[model samples]
Each structure stands twice: as C-alpha cells, then as structure tokens.
Target: MAHEKRAYPLWTELPYAGKTHSPTIAGGVEPDAGKWKTYFIQHSRRHGFKKLDGRPIRLAIKDPDSIDWYAQLKVVQHTLENLSDQEKRIAEYWSAGPPTKQWIPIVDRLIDTYAIEAPRAARILSAVFGGMNDAFVVCWALKYKWLVPRPNQLDQHLATYICTPEHPSYPSGHATISGAAEVILSYFFPAERQKLHRLAEENAQSRLYAGVHYPVDNTEGLRLGRQIGRIVIEELKKDTVNGLPIERSSREFRNADIITRTYEQAIPFDYKSKCDSLLIRDDESTGNSSTKDWIDPKLFI
Candidate 1:
C-alpha cells in the first residue's frame, strides 16, 4: 500500500502499521510457531510450564479458504456500502492503534469508575493486556499462514474510513485483542460482563465499519481471542497471596456500586503528558501487583 502523505498520516496509517506482522517474520512455517517470542515465555517460565487447563494454550484459527469466498466478499461490500457517516465516526473511535493499544483508556476509565484499589486494578490490567498480547501472537501466525487478501484487494474502488492495514486479512487484530480483553476483563469485573462483551463485539465490527476486514476475519478472530484469554485467566487464577486467589469475586464489582465508564474517539492535545497515569499506571514504584515484579508488561488493553 502506497503511503498517503497527508496531515496526521500516522493516525490513518500508523508508523510500522500494527498489522504488518506476519507469521513468516518469526521464522517461516515452523510447527513451533506457538513458541515464537511469546511474552509469557519469559515471564511465565519461572512460574513453571503452564497450559490453558490441561493442554497447550494455542488458538486453532479457522482456515479462511474453507469458507465460500464470494459470500464473505458480499458481507464486506454490504458493510462498507451501507456504512453511514455516524457509523464511520463510531468505527474510527474504536480503531485502536495496533497491535490494539487503544483499549488502555477504556480500562483506565473502568478503574476510575469502579474506584478499584491500586493493587487490584493493576492485576486486572495486567491479565487483560497479557491475554491480548497472547492472542496477537497466534493471530499473526494464522494471518501469514492463511495469507488471505483484504476486501479492498478484491475491489479497489471500495472507500475505507481509515487506511487499510498492510497485512494478510484472515484474523482481524483488533477483534482478536478485543476478544481477549473482553474475556479477561469480564472475568475480573464480571459485573460489567454485558457491557464489556458488547464493547468487544463492537470493536470487532469496527474493522468491518472501516472497510478493512471481511466478516470472517472478525468472526474467527473473536473466537481465537477468547480462547487465548481463557488460558491467561487460568494462569492468573493460579497466583495466591497469603493463600487466597488473586482473582476477586464478582459481587465486589457490581455495576450499581461503581460509577459508569464510557469511551470516545477524542485525543487530548497533550495526550503524551496525561497518558502516563491513565494508560500505564506507575505501579512498579508502589509494588501494586506481584505479576509486575517479573513481567512488568506494558498495558495495551
């Protein structure tokens, strides 16, 4: 895809387009593609070999080729063709920077609205973002393995709300990340289960609204992402402090008890200065989460 030199080009097409990642980049076609640079490999290694439950926590992404090709294209065409101006604005609002980092603010707002204590909120963010990253690893692997073309490739005249990412289109990265986040966050904040999941579904659909992904891309991505998230949840539940599960009860996270949290597409002019606290809370200094001691993962969810 040729770079469109316009004001704020980075927003339309981020530097190093988040989805440029391919399975081949991590050593082409290795059966052990699952082992390729997973964040948990280093962080969870010391904790001991872990699995989703009894088996390996890997996503079996559906082969896009198996589906009817024209049927999928019709979905893309319908979504793009009927996309209203308001829907485009809404979709653009949901388009997280790849590899899907926009979920940070949403998480932050949730924390603030719930007034969750520092330690608890840290644990929640860590698990959710970690799961998302895990999903991305699998998503990229399947993306290059399938090498499915984007909707625009089939029809060049298709107008997109944002620059279509340069990558194989089988699994939508946004959908994958959203799926993982939805599961992990819902686990910790089960009271917000309905809202959290609705957001996840919307996030997946946003790709279609942007005219970037076919229907199957969002569909399979969401499924794969949820599986990855469950694995992370299983691992998160293993942690104990004073012999109690780090995972808390849903009763404590009731919607009535917490303030409402909402998200929008707006970015503050001084976003750089304000993001430090809202996005990645400086929990390391305060020793907010035990997971941070080892992983110290950056929060993208």
Candidate 2:
C-alpha cells in the first residue's frame, strides 16, 4: 500500500495546513521505515538471540473499507465529543514528546527509588531501551505496510486535540513503546508490575483521547510491543558469566506504592470486547469450533 496525505488540514496552526506529509520530504522523521528491522539489541548476538524481524507480524484487524472499520471510527468520534477533563489532561501529558521522553524519566525514578546499583541500573536501561527500539522497528514496518490513515484522515470533519503525527496510524508508536517499557521494567521490578501496566494502558488510551488513533491501533500496538519485550527478556536470560545466568532482582517500597496509588482509577475503554463478540459470532456461523484456529501463532511467538 502507498502512504497518502491527510485529507483535512492539521488542527494545529502551522504550515501543515497547505503542505502534505511525506516521510521522504525534508522535515520528515525516519524516511526509511524498513532500515531498522534487522537491528540487534546489545546482548542479542552474545546470547544467540535471532535478530527481530517485524515483517512477519500482522494485526488481526478489519479492512479499512469494512463496516467494522467505520464502527471503530465512530468510537473515536464518540470519544472526542465526550472527552472528560481527565482524558484531555491525559492526552496532553503523553503528547509532550515521543514515548522515550517520558519513559526515560520513569526508568530514572525507578532506579533512584529502589537504590539500584550501577550494574543493575545499566542493565535496566539497556534492556528497556533496546526492547523499545525493536518495538518501534516492528510498529513502523507494519504502519507503512498497512498505511492506515489517522482517524482525522478518515473523517475530514474530525479535529484532534493534538496534532496528528506524520506517519501512518495502524499501531500507535506511543502504545508500542509503553508496552515494551511496561514489560521490561516489570521484569526488573515485579512489585511495580500493576502500576507499570496501568501506565502503559493509559499511554495507549491517550492516543484515542487525542482523537488521533482507532482503538485497534492501541490494542494491536500493545500486543506487538509486549511480544518484543518478552523476546528481549528471553535474550537477557541467556546472558551468562561463566555459565551462570546474570542476577535479576526485584524491589518494593511503601513510598512507591503510595505514590502510584494516587493515579486515577477508572475502567479503560473495552476495545476488545466488540472484536471478541464478532469472533464468537463467526465461530457460530461456521462449523469451526477451535479457538486456536482463529489465533495468529506468530503474535504469541
């Protein structure tokens, strides 16, 4: 599929109003989307981990022309019209920059809070960042491959709270990075798993709150990122000194828990429920009864 320009002008007051977006153009970021697919993490070669390839990962989403696709669009429109004050704040907070800008501070905070030593802190940073790099490579590959339009692109009347990104929006970059951060950080700090996951979820949802992505973008992005995170963890487990695996530790503090508890508590939008219900309906229509048949095994791998 070919990437296309936005049908409507950018919501932001900028030169984007008259100009179209092209990654190959002067101001574009990462013009060559496929270049990083074969990049290896720090310990990948040392641990014999195969270079991660994003080309094979496919999202189980409806075609953009299908009824379900429009249904998903309607969800975005509904969200934009009914955005709560909290949701608006969430969008602005995460929109500060690319995912790394926020994640680095989080990692630093965790390292300081736990009083982690130099060696452990180094490992945490390397693993999390490495995993996020791989996740982006994969996410970008699929994004350009699908070339799905932003929610505003599909609906010209729709105006976003934040400026729409130049790249295609199938799987969200922020969600993908957040997912990778959630898994890698949780591995090092299991006590904070729930809190880390909540952060990741909110990061993903923030895209929708900003009216930039379809719900499926966040859902599939999280799944894709988590897969990369698991792969990174597997590679890390193989790193050994004199045939013994390197030390991995977890820590907890009452202060950390108290701080995390202050985050807002509310049910996230259930994007998957509608998709699941449709899958069940298909199962009933067809004679096929095995749930495994519907699942893409590569996603799990």
Candidate 3:
C-alpha cells in the first residue's frame, strides 16, 4: 500500500480519466485533447477541405484479451535483458515528454531537409502535431480501458532505465504520438517516407528498451496512432491558392520558416534516471556488468 498510495494521479477531475487499480490505470481519456477536436482552425472537418460532421475514421484499439500477452512479455524481457547503453540513451530521451517538445528537433530537421517555405512549414507542423495530439486522446482512452500493467509490476525485481509513466501500459503514449507524427509528416514530405517511418519504429522500440512498457503496448499504440494520423492527413490535403494546389497556414506557427533546434538546448526534461550510472554488460546471456560513468546524453534532459 505504501508505493501504491504514492502513485500520482494523471487526471482525477475528468470522468473519462478512469480509475486506478493495482498500480494499473483504467478508463483513460484526455478531455483537453477532446476539446482540441472542436478546434477547427487547423484542420477540422467543419473548416477544412472536407466538411464531414464527424471524424474521418474511428480509432481501432483492440481488446486486451486478444493480445498474446505471454509472448509480449517475452519480447519486453528480451529487450531489457539485451539493452545496451546506447539504446538506453535513446529510450531515456523519449521518456522525458510528449511530442510538443521532444519532437521539435525531428520536425526542424525535416524542414531543413526539404527547405520548406515558412507558411507551408507551418501547415505541415500543424497537421503533424495536431494529429499527434489526436492520437494521444485515442491511445490513452484505450490504455485505461485496457488497464494493462507496466513491466515492473509483473516482475518486482525489474529495474527500468527510466521512470515509468503513471498510466496503463497497453498502448505507449510516445509510440502512439510518434506513429501519428510519422504518417502525417510523410504525407507532407513523401520523399522522406522511409526515414520518417524508421523514426516511428525506433520511437516504439524505445519503450521496450526502457523496460517500462511491453512489446504489444508499442505495437498496438503505433497501429492505432497511424490510423489517426491518416485521418488528419486526409483533412490536411484539402487546400487551394487561387485554384492552384497548395497547403500552409493551417494553424499558428513560429515566425521563422526554417526552424531548427539545437539538441543540447532543446531537451524537454530533467528528471534523474531511476537506474544506476553507465555500465555495459559484457554478455547478454551471462548478465555480467562493469561500471563507468558515461557522458550525459543531453545537457537539459
């Protein structure tokens, strides 16, 4: 009861935020994101190229029972057991926060890659980030609805590389949001489709390496979030400048067109890691370890 009582409440005020049980969160929903849906300024059906009264497509988070949980746990175990310091660095980076900040560098990189015009850059970011938020709404709802457990709960002796988020672990929030970002961004920059897709895959995998979420959590989150992203992209494509095809100024944006983030200055988090300092195991099979302080991956977080 000691640790259980100490767990944080993500949003107890909202009805859909759900209830907690056994260190597992249930019945999740982000009311703020739902409120975001009413915001038609960016790309809502009411004010976009498409004028449908409802969402383009419904979310598809499957019933938890349908998942092969044992196999899922095995994958999480494998990733944790085989985790390298480099992989841990990547995972810890994402565990910091959601797309609002952690994603700035990636978006900036894309803008630089394509040299996107200022106004147009604004539109792409609006679509990508808006979709990212939408995906979170669906993902969290499914998370609490499923009320899955984190890897640590299943195995008390397990030590996660990052602090586990205080929510159900069925669908990873980072994976879900990143999945949506990849799809929405790809629609704007099809030339970088492979790279964007790879980023999404890595974002999902990072959850496993963190040892906080299971494999299925990531897989399902990505799948569900991708679907949400497609919906947002479909809405973003409707644009015309004097009957000529173009898209931009779909939402608010930073003034500069070629936005770039200095990674050292852009890290969005600053929490201490829950695990020990740097040490690489000599072998995955034998689980032997040595200790040596490694370089901090980022300055801010």
Candidate 4:
C-alpha cells in the first residue's frame, strides 16, 4: 500500500471551512500511485467497463486518477463518514443548534434594512463590518486549533439536516461573526443592542438549522466574538484605520447600557417607516454627539 499527498479541491473547502485537523500517520500504508492506477483498471474490468469499446472505456482511461474513477474517492468518502458519525455522538451532551430562538425575526428585519442612507449607510456598515473581520479570523483559527467535530456525525439521536461540513466544531464561525457585527453596530445605535444581540445569536443558530454546526459551537463562538468586539472597541479608542475614527475622548463617551437605552427610546421600534423624521438633529453626525473629541489622526496608535 502506498499513499499520495493529494490536495483537496477548492470547492470542497467550503464544507470543511475551519477544519485544521491533520491525519495521523499511525501505521498507515503509503499509497503507490502506479499500483493505484493498476487497481483502478482491475476494478473497471470487474465492473465490466473493459467490455466497452468507445466512450465509457475512453472516459475511464482519460480519468483514471480522478477520485470517483479511482481509490481517493473511497478514502475521502469514508474519512468524512467516520468523522460525521463521531460528531453525532458528541452532539448528544448538548443541543444541536442555535442557543436562542427569540432573535430570528429581529435579524430578519435588520438584514432586510441593511441598506438605509445609500453611501453613508454603506460606509457605516462597512466600518462596522471591519470591526467584525478580526473576530471571524481569530475564531476560525481557534476552531482549527480546537479541532472539535460537529454534531451531525457524532450523535445518533441528533438528526442533522445539512450535509456535514468538513470543519472542526468548537467556536461557531457564524455566532462569532454575527456577535462582533452586533457589538459594533450596537455601539453606534445603543437602543438596538438587545435586538442586535438577539440577531447575532440567531444567526449563529441558523448554522445548526443549516445542519453545519452544533449548539456548543455557537455558545463558545459567541463568547469569543464578544471578546474580540471589546478588544476592537478598546483599540479603536487608541488608533485609526484608513481615516475611520477609532478613538474617542473619555469625556464624550457614555456607558454602553445608558447610551443604548436612550437610543431605543429615541428611535422607537418602528422607526424605519419614519426615516424622514430621524434626522441627525444637529451635527451629531460630525461633532461628537456623546461629547467626545474626534480621535486625532496623530493620536491614533
């Protein structure tokens, strides 16, 4: 037996987005590519392909090294099958999907209203998303390090709906990504924090419904995401990124809870319909609405 160092195809990368686990060498046999070709030829003969004179025979010879035509298909197929089976077993200790159910409609609304002020809204949303980028990178990197399997393959009782994604299950990427976005947007519009947080939580849970992640994956993932958001906020207070204001004076900032409560009261839940009434009032858009000085470009660390 001989083995080959085959690179996984790019399309397959999506299913196993954060899996970083490497195979164990153990007493694994080294595959012989030449012998593998011979074996495939023999299998083809057994399957009656040898009797074909035209297209089918030509196809087999032309694609002898392809996975479906050869042994790599079996190797990868069984490896994933085993991993999913094991993941299903692990999913039993906890729930298999989103940790909360209350946030779905909230997020649905937010996503529906993702566009508001055209360019300005785009800029604001872009800045908010920038705060989220680091969270996903770190979370996914940690996921690879943790190398936890997902629930679909681990527990027999947990019937996963999505095809098992080929990623490690630890920190849920969806949860962390959504959480970071929520934290940043919530800072800007404090009144919407609960709704935003719920949205984030629900986004994480959708992965479970999608059958690609487990409940614990979202829980841990959300925790990590919030931590990343806090770190980004602190850093923003001291630095600048591409002309976006990151830092604010201590005098201008309010407690997050108070700011959020006031914002919600001011904006109201049905504020979208009255977009005309939601004017900036003053230069709250320019001057520090919270009494904070714009972080000077020089002071940005």
TM for every model, in the order presented, reads 0.69, 0.71, 0.69, 0.42
Candidate closest to the true structure, highest TM-score: 2
lDDT of 4 by residue, 1-301 (tens): 1225332222112222222332222211121111222111121432322211222222111111222212322332343344443333232111222222222333334434533345445544554565455554455444443344444333322323233433455566667766766776666555567767765775665555434454555666677667556555554444467976643322232223211211122222321111110111224222212232222211110
Name the weakest run of 10 consecutive residues (lDDT summed) in model 4.
271-280
Clash count, one per candidate? 0, 0, 1, 26
Which digits, one per residue and each the tens of the lDDT, describe model 1 over residues 169-219? 678888898888888878877778888888788888888886677887898
Question: Which residue pairs clash within candidate 2?
Answer: none
Worst 10 residues of 2 by lDDT: 271-280
- Residue runs of model 4 more than 4 Å from their true location after superposition: 1-123, 156-158, 239-301
Ordered list by TM-score, greatest first: 2, 1, 3, 4
**TM-score, prediction 3:** 0.69
Q: Candidate 1 at residue 41, lDDT?
A: 24
Error of 3 at 229 (Å): 1.1
Q: What is the Cα-based TM-score of model 4?
A: 0.42
Cα lDDT listed for each candidate: 0.59, 0.62, 0.58, 0.40
Q: In model 1, which runs have C-alpha deviations exceeding 4 angstroms?
A: 1-36, 39-54, 57-60, 253-263, 266-301
**Reference-based lDDT, residue 95, model 1:** 51
Candidate 2 local lDDT, 1-301, one digit each (tens): 3325443222221222113432322233453543464334321323322434423333333333332556778999999788776786677567654666667667887888888899989988888887888788767755655566566655655656555566667778888888888998888888888888988999899989877788988887888788778777877887899998886554554345412333332222211111110111123323222221322211111
- Ranking of all candidate structures by their lDDT, best first: 2, 1, 3, 4
